[model samples]
Target: MSSHLLPNLTAAHLFEAILAIALVFSCLLGLQVIRERRPPAVTLAWVAVLVLLPMLGVLLYLLFGTRKRWELRVRQRPVIGCETAVRPFDDAHVLDRMLRRLALPPALSGNDIRCSWRPEVARRDLLDVIDGATERLWMFIYMFEDDASGALVLDALIAAASRGVRVRVMVDDLGSFGSLAAGRRALEAAGGRMVRFKPVWYALRKRMLNLRNHRKIVVADGQVAWTGGRNVGDHYLAAGKHEWLDFSAVIRGPTALALEEICRNDWRFASDEPPDSSPVWVSGPQGNACLQVLPAGPEYRDDAWQTALVKCCFEAHSRLWLATPYFVPDETVTNAVLTAARSGVDVRILVPHRSDNLVVDLVGRSFLREVQRAGGKVFRYKIGMMHAKAVLVDDTLAMFGSANIDARSLFLNYECMVIGYDAETVIPVQAFFEYAFARASRGVRTIGQIRETLSSLARLLAPLL
Candidate 1:
């Protein structure tokens, strides 16, 4: 019948139109990828997703594959020609040369580093420093809760602001959205400035839901700074039922100026406020610690943390000990660790037994067998969640800050770490590792059937973790 033929023709035309639209969209996406010029592996992965999954793949890419904002990129351009003004104690180490090549501020000596592993002690020190702030106070925390401990910090900031102290607070949009209104209102009402770093709505609008500023930095009066894995919250500070074993370092010296500069750059990027180019360099050395600050994130063309960490693994002749709550290292890191361990390096990785992220916990377990096979040791902390992020190489080198041993931290998140080549700074972090190792249960190559199955499935999605 003519009527049936017409209906069939119409349906076929509609299907053809849909297919054409999809093809056009895929081509456009491919072109955009080419323009961005990402790494071959990342580009291929994205292209494969687009080709295989069509609309859904494109949607996922839109949500997660975008780069850092143009504003941030522009702001960081000056670092390219920035000279390393400070100098390290030993310029002989290959690490120092690598850092200098990256255009990082020189490794400065005469810095004092005090580390605290106990939650209450760390919080006490943090609050004390805040209370003692005189000139300027800047805090960039990923999570700023309104709970008991958080309230104390907030009140301290408010009081400091009221007393004419310059205070600026920056928190991650998604991580601390619940505290946004209250925190801003409390701080602004007291004359302090506050801004959310890359708000979630901004990310959604820009189709960039993956990048987050996860740094926890506190700089007071440009004289001292505190930073590490701990955020501003009751769980991270107080002795709660589910307390975490966290570590923070209080640093004083010219290194504090380096930390203050990091906070200033981040604050200016988020607020678009006039740059604070005021010098905060100390007139004299505060101690004898040699420290180099490494600020890593998606803004840079190269992954600073990844490069440094890989070099740290490969260059270690004696020992390499690392600790983090998450351990989903990329293939490069994994291979480097395996190669180093097999070469008789005392490579050890410490992770928490009970992690805050279930997927990360499961996926982390999958790497244990391979590491063990390479003669490396994996230790699981039985003590509450160990949220410390630290690295110890031999006896003179140590690093600690907000980075994790995972793809997200290494390549996605805005993170910072201080690399110290002095025993004064490295010794405490090494001691902390020793303490955690003493309380850790050495990894077994096998696990229960159910967990093993879950972990196997989780490891399949490790790249996304």
Candidate 2:
């Protein structure tokens, strides 16, 4: 054979070998997906993709399909078994029981809860907590920008550390990549500590790029706590064209200790250092509000938060109100909303007129239309980006925290939610909903043909997103 012919033959053989390897790998992934027993639609989608597009399918599955990571499985389990200091209200017995069965902490009374709707107020409340800390301060946020707002909060933390208060901050490596260096240098210089949750390079090396820490929580002295959708950024603190409307709650009581437990678990996972024991609750009950703290992520065996949310939709007796920045829900949640609205329960959903992501907006329209067809009302906020994630079911249950109504928040990321079961917590959340509803534009009952077709196409990719 000629020399050039031999080179070409070698190249062709290499290509064929690569193709055979990819085919075998794809088949193995398909079998693994089936054995996992996911939703029927999801399973079919994976099988089709793996069979038809072997190389691309293998890459996509490695990035997004895998649900659990080996590193997390080997890490320490979450701390539980915190005894409920007080019983939940009679109306909330069912929800309390459901959470208990999921191995979540029970609802406890004596929490003094306060909600902040406006950006300025939320910013003030956060600063106040940082400034007033006397013993220890812990914060876990997804995004921490290097803008003016971030500097203000960092300065406060530095001062707290200088004053002998233990301060620690954990931020998502990808979400806050732009400011991580500056934050780490400044905090460590001031005698504080900072760590990144699943750093981007580490996640990419491990083929777990899609997993993220999305929870935003701050605990001060193990007594006062704050958790919400707003991250530390100029858009979340300032009032301007780029401002975002969000919600946050400040809790002063035993519930704060529960929030601390969550922080400790996350810190341990990120830093691999044993967390300090929780401080003793000396002052006792702060008020009469009842609250439960739920932490959910891929680390858990089941989708505990998603199950609780679906149950809330089915348990609503008189009303169900949901507000979120994103509204792409899975089949189970979609059907629950449809059934609730069709059963004569007052159902309403509030979302931003246009969110930051175009694909999410298009995918959400199809889901929103289904709810509208079932007699549920939809409201689109027009004044600014609506970034709050809250749910109210009748007058007995209320939820507000970092998780949105989309698949990423519900199934992929680390999320925390505070469930309140009394007038003290529910009344404020209800008022915030009413205020936003009045400012938002009602969803039109119709859309153009081209838009409808685009939305339907986008719905096909919802599972991957």
Candidate 3:
């Protein structure tokens, strides 16, 4: 029983162990700080996973982060676009057929559409229309960059609300982070209300980081609705980045009601309020152009908008025009394009020669060979970036929205878009597409093509987009 015989633990050993634990905890805390403003729940979840299994937890988040950002289609259908224009809609006859194949109420044109070439112009005119109203203004956007242009829109909402207009706003956590604090302050000071969706802090499995609120719309008095690819930011609004080009469409009718429903759902979800059913949506008369709000979000139906677009792409009997900055398509969508093109559909894809997201551009290149082999032609816009997200099928049916061709737009983020089948409405949209097309150059992507084939890793990540 000699005390000297007992093994003595050194002070240095204890100190080293303490330091290691502190280091891990410090890393976890630092990540949370960097991510900032995620939902309190998300932040806590991250903490729990990391605390429980630090190294594995970190690895899991990295692998899944990219996938988590993508909104994957939960179901598939043969066709999804609603043909609304009576005279121009060749596909309207398929409504009865779709009732069984797609399980969606056959859509018909019930709204007036006004297309704007620039996102900033769209933003101002939309705010003006919503501000001009006395009843209510609902503004929902994925990104609200902290810049002068964003302030202008915020001020417009403010002035409207000051005059007794009920204004509600929703902004996503990830997109708004870099510019959120200032925007939030101004909104509060203006007597306007704003809520951030899914604020996740850095930890393992950061809940809100990948699932963004990507929908952009402004619904006023249930009469006018604005939807498109433009987020509220300098680049999208072409505020600082004069070269940035985007598209948006204005809607007025029962379809507008559907957009309003989406905005209401977003606002309520983002807000602190216990959601009450958005006052019974006031459906309007069937207007000249038929339209419907196809939605895809976590709280709502999954990838319905995406499924609709892919189906329409397959059904394109004539020309297919697609414009998106990011072109990373999941296999199902990629295969759909290939099938349509292989079947002799005249498919053309328009993408930016230089996009803000380089990885996305690379991921898009990862699919060129197959699309090209299927008789699809790809163009890279050289004049400026093409941020337009629209599709024209047979020059009859058309679509516009925040949805990108990439996995992020379809399955991961909250996306909203409109489908219409009016030559009256779509002719102008087609003309707009042609204008952008004229400025673009046919891509001779030998380098990109080879690289794409070599880099199977990127394409493997496509479904997670």
Identify the candidate with maximal TM-score: 2
Of 1 and 2, which scores higher on lDDT?
Answer: 2
Give the 10-residue window scoring lowest on summed lDDT in candidate 1: 74-83
Model 1 spans with C-alpha error above 4 angstroms: 1-22, 31-42, 68-71, 74-85, 88-92, 277-282, 445-457
User: Which candidate's lDDT is highest?
Assistant: 2
TM-scores for all predictions: 0.90, 0.93, 0.77
Residue-level lDDT for 52 in candidate 1: 81
Residue-pair clashes per candidate: 1, 0, 15
Error of 1 at 293 (Å): 0.9
* Model 3 score (lDDT): 0.68
Q: What TM-score quantifies how close candidate 1 is to the native fold?
A: 0.90
Which pairs in model 2 have colliding backbones? none
* Candidate 3 worst ten-residue window by lDDT: 72-81
Q: What value does the lDDT take at residue 286 in candidate 3?
A: 45
Full candidate order by lDDT, most accurate first: 2, 1, 3
Per residue, candidate 1 scores C-alpha lDDT tens digits across 93-184 of 67878876876666877778899888898898898778889988999999998888898889889999999889999999988887768768
Model 1 accuracy (lDDT, Cα): 0.83
